[model samples]
Target: MKQKSTSPWAWVPTLYFAEGIPYVVVMTVSVIMYKRLGISNADIALYTSWLYLPWVIKFAWSPLVDILKTKRWWIVVMQLLIGAGLGGVALTIPVPDFFQYTLLFFWLLAFSSATHDIAADGFYMLDLDEHKQAYFIGIRSTFYRLAMITGQGLLIILAGFIESSTGLEPVEFSVTTQSTHTEWVVPQAKSVTTGGENQFVVTQADVVIGLNKLNKIQADSIKDWAHKQNLSNGFVIKEVQLEQAPGWWSSNVATPLKESLKERFGKEDKSAMFKGEVQGNIAAFGIRLAQMPEEGENVVLNLDRQSGAKDLSLVEGHRLTFNNQNWDQQAWVLVQADPKLDTAVSADFRGLSGNIPFAWSVTFFVLAILFVVFLIYHRFFLPRPAADKPVAESKNMLNEFVETFVSFFKKENFAIGLLFILVFRLGESQLVKLASPFLLDAREAGGLGLTTGDVGLIYGTIGIIFLTLGGIIGGYLASRNGLKYWIWWMTLAINLPNLTYVYLSYATPESMWIVACSVAVEQFGYGFGFTAYMLYLIYFSEGKSKTAHYAICSGLMALGMMIPGMISGWLQEIVGYQNFFIWVMICTIPGFLIIKFLKIDPTFGIKKQ
Candidate 1:
């Protein structure tokens, strides 16, 4: 039977849109999700970095798609599998072993998605003629990016909204500071009382911290102790422990490790207590739930600076989780005022309780259903072309597979090309893994301290917009002057903007607009600089088997991203965010050094009249 002709518009956009969703969810959304769920940065980076494996090795199985089945058949089956994987992720999120189970599902999603990529790209060429292919390329890319915005921006925002709304009404508090003539002293503790049903209560609604000047020796000692605790700008947090014992891990493992560290360094100086003449003021507030949460329900408290003096910073108790077992236990919030503040200043903080796991589960459930819809729509609407069939010489498939890789390695300057591919984005690979975590982490931990919703708006929506504009402008300039002329400039564009992170780590700006604009600048530079990298892949893949070779190049690119990303979190913990970003800047040096040894066609990216 003769296949009917269908407009490329009917399926191309949706096809590519489907392609982008799983990749973003796996790469970007997973990072944010893990961070929010209280996974340590080291574990989040290491585990999620491993998720890139399927993509990195997908090229190895490309020949299977060609020999065993038709591309259209592969595409439909993979979509179904992808949907099932997403559903599995949704189901596992609320379980006790959610981390392990969700990762298992995500692995299934990754492999299925990678296979889908192989099939879809192959199907695009088979379904459309050369003329239509050229015309619809931009349309496909646009829809793919729309999928990114959907996953990175809208989906995250939806989760954040659900998180904020599903729990109890938010609690608010205020802190004020005043300079007093009398010597400053710590306030005496008062017993906390339970509130009415379903109410969350705080020990104090308002706190006043006394400001005073201390002798130079006392100030210096206090500063040293605070610095040792990762407190900065003259802030310190003091925990008031309850009578009940901590968990086994905290009692046995964590406590021992902390003691060892103190032994290795020096015992904390009690004499170094707050007695500063021109030092920051400190205050504490306590929170607890009046009633126990029902079985399987957990109340999460997230405290953030709503509005006030930019100088007021929360040094501890940014996030606390409570359930039936610990609903009565009180958690303390410690705030510090900058030493330079002499006049009265005030700040307000709001504590929100939301079901984070439920919100994320709903988000994944939405993705699963969306993919099912895609599977159904494409099952009916996808065009069948004459050339969309299995390869004829199935017997030679093994030989052909081996020859494809062998020939790629035989190309001139293959070593240089491989090295260039691996080293070009070393800094970027590490930065991408930790960027969201940096924004979401607490201020005391040397991060920007933004909420999930705030991160979505700033890094996802606004950053992506600037990223697209930068790419557009970069392409135009490269087409005008060619790749060689713009290579150095592009390299600088990608690496220099990393300094924005360095500044953010040090300055810790509280203004949303400032944070958004800084992220925009960095993302734009990344997009602009990435043009050179993509063009180089195209240039190097120019050969008799260009498609196969390009797939190989892509795998190597993913490998480059994977390794650095895996170790970034561990590195950040050691050096701190400020120094870690400076290290990223230092990593850029190798990329620049490699450029000096590269051989390129001067007119490669120039457009022909």
Candidate 2:
């Protein structure tokens, strides 16, 4: 039967778009989500960085993709596998052991996604002729980047919106008051006016007893006496009062007792009589009320009861009695709180108080659904190619695998070439791992203090555009002048913008434009400089087994990224963002030094005139 033909356009964009999603989710989106979910940066970096393992070792199974199934078959199957993995992650996210469980699914996603990449790349070459391959490569690449935007930009912003909506606002303090008896229940149904709105709040406040040093005077003479004693701000007033004998104007009250009396009463009320009978050495007993806030000032009193003894201690229960030597009393300090907090209620459900599992579950499920759609669409539109044999065909699979591994090491300067590829991106790998956290962390934590949405907008959307533009420009420049002339410049390009991160760490700019520009500059340089790295890999892979060698090189590239990224979070947590970025700049030195010794043909990666 003759095969039905399908245009490359019918599936190319979606094909590459599907290719980019799982990779971005496994590598980047997971980092951001874990950070937002309060996973320590160390764990996030360590675990997620390990997800790179699949990509690094993908060459091990590259032959299986060609031998076991058709390229089109592998593509569709991997899509379904990836989709299933995503769904698994979503299901595990809300479970009790979500961190460990979700990571297990992420690993599955990563391996499946890497396999998908291998099959898709092979299928692209097999399906299209030479001219069409060159023509549509950019189209495929553009859609791949668009997938990044969807994952990093739109998806993250959605996560942020859900987070804010479900998250509880911070608590504000109300007022404090002293109760003589420990008999007060927390005063309920209290209201306050805040932000031009009236709200009832549940308030917790601190109360002091015995002697309290005060700023505003409860009585004027007490203020004057406090001033005369060189006591400013406020006077220390005791809970109980001192007594003078009845009709004792002529009786000189002890000067020590005089000070205590004046301090308590602001001056003796000579006309006032002791109402209740006092026992031995007794005067009067009561708690002096602190001058309250102005009427209509929305405030609630939090009463703190304490024993009115020499040692002011918290009251043990709702009631306390005075002994012959002392009286009982309490005092408190006031604090401000949001009036709107009055209406906020704590969630009684299973830890749904702060996190919205439904939101994340829906997001991941939607992503899985999209892949299902992709799987269905491609199954229909993607044409099966006639040439389905492995690029290097052999009857013995083990022999082909051994040959693939051994041939890479047999190449000239293989050690140095491999080393260059492995370390060229060392600084960049660690930098990318920590950049999102630094951008999203609070300013006080030595980060940019940007919201998730802002990070999505600036780094994901704006930065990606510049990165792509830089790559295009870099490709043009390398083609015209060759990789040799631009190699050192490319090294500089890749390494220099790293200082922008250092600058950002130090400046901690709040302005989104400044942040966007900084990220743009850094990403552009990364895109531009990365051209030399890619070309060098292609150049070194030249040989009879070029395809397998190139696959091995890509594996090493992933390894380079994985190792540094694995440690970056721990390093960032230890040294902090500012110093961590400085460390990233320092790591660039090895790459620069390695490039100095690289042997490159002047004509490499250049088209001859």
Top model by TM-score, which number? Answer: 1
Candidate closest to the true structure, highest lDDT: 1
Model 2 lDDT tens row, 335-361: 111111212111110111124465677
Put down candidate 1 lDDT per residue, 1-609, tens digits, no spaces: 666788988999999999999999999999888766766667788899999889888888876676566788998999999999999989999899999999999999999999998788777766654334434544666688999878888988887778878778787899887877434333344454555658677777887876654555654554444343322221122333348769998789866765664455433343234323344656766576778789976676767787777567776666666777666755556776665456778888877677788889999999999999999999999988777776635458777777777888999998888899999999999999889988876665667766555676887579978887777677667767777888899999998999999989989998889889889999999878887887777678665455556668888898899899987886676556777788899999899998888888886666444
RMSD of each: 9.8, 21.1
Enumerate residue pairs that collide in model 2. Answer: 182-318, 200-342, 214-234, 215-233, 222-266
Each model's lDDT: 0.77, 0.64
Candidate 1 residue spans exceeding 4 A from truth? 1-16, 31-49, 95-97, 120-149, 163-167, 172-196, 204-283, 292-315, 323-326, 335-357, 380-393, 411-465, 474-526, 539-548, 559-609
lDDT of 2 at 390: 55
Candidate 1: C-alpha RMSD to true structure equals 9.8
In order of listing, the candidates' clash counts read: 4, 5
